[model samples]
Target: MKPILLLFIFVSTLFATQYSVIISKKVDVGTLSAQQVRDIFLQKRHSLGNQKIIPLNLVGQEPSRIAFETDVLGMGRDRLNTYWIKQHFQGITPPITQPSHESIKAFVQNVEGAIGYIPSSMVDNSVKVLYEF
Candidate 1:
């Protein structure tokens, strides 16, 4: 294999494995099914149990934001933009959006019924990882 190709593969693999989302430690919810988590993130439904659900997102230009939309939300950029635009025209805004992972973490920690995604390594005792994938 070409050295340059191998180097590209190595760097991509390394970063890909390094991101994840976390929640408060007190959050008793176990590993959530992917679909349920998706629902919450999309605001398709509320309440992940008795706990009302509030989803948060990273800033618009962030790579992690793209990953969450494509990898987790399974929506392409165009489609998501259209969805949000329609929601706006309908007088409904999407979930709270933060400018960075750090802001997302702080918001999730401070707000009840809040859930957000960040790098996997960022997981700490202050938050629980509802899912990783």
Candidate 2:
């Protein structure tokens, strides 16, 4: 029975599809703590490890965006949207945006100081995982 219970927990964890925040290998800040990555993605910080950090994001309606907001930024979708909207009104556009995860990965690879998030399975050697939740 204990083995069955353990298996149940493990399987549930897997199905939860834990998401990860990732960056390009070229940006050598090393793995970021959850809070540090949160600050960067939320646009609260401009630099990390001597590199001027530029946070990239998926489209507003994308599912991964919600997962990233909840898991990494600790904000609800509505609150995040409001936050960005206010930034936009204040003439500060939110981090660079991409239409899809692939585009985000591509942009981060080509640009220095760029960071973004995607599903764990989608990540590859080209990008490095900074944090996971």
Candidate 3:
């Protein structure tokens, strides 16, 4: 390979963060479309077939959250905030939150029906990736 190509690849790899939606190995969900994942996170739809779905979220101004919101949920922070506020009045609320990707993975691994997103590179045998962004 050419040196320029090699350098470009290295730089991109260093800066880029690939994110994915993941679930506990125990959850029986199949691959989900972006829309389905968005619904789950937004609390608009719950359960996939027989299994109940519990979505996890990263807290406040997180880069992973920003990317996931933009790429998958197709909403900005302001829009999401307004949405949740309206839902709140009707007794609906946002998903549970964890502080970091490591916490998210651990939560998914141990909690049945638990699902969340994190950096794609953080995934391991403990969790099943349902969608990527």
State each candidate's clash count. Answer: 6, 0, 0
Report the C-alpha lDDT of model 2 over 44-133, residue by residue, as the tens digit.
788976889889888777878887788778899889879989888777767888998888878878888888887788888988888887
- TM-score of each model, paired residue for residue: 0.84, 0.82, 0.88
Candidate No. with top TM-score: 3
lDDT of prediction 1: 0.80
- Predictions in order: lDDT: 0.80, 0.82, 0.91
Tell me the tens digit of each residue's lDDT in model 1 across 1-133: 6999999999998767555666666566777877887887777778866887778887667888887788888999899889889878777778888888888888878887778888887788788888877
Candidates 1 and 3 compared: the better one by lDDT is: 3
**Model 1 poorest 10 in a row by lDDT:** 17-26
Which candidate wins on lDDT? 3
Q: Clash pairs of candidate 3?
A: none
Off by over 4 Å in 2: 1-10, 88-91
lDDT of prediction 3 = 0.91
Alpha-carbon runs more than 4 Å astray in model 3: 1-15
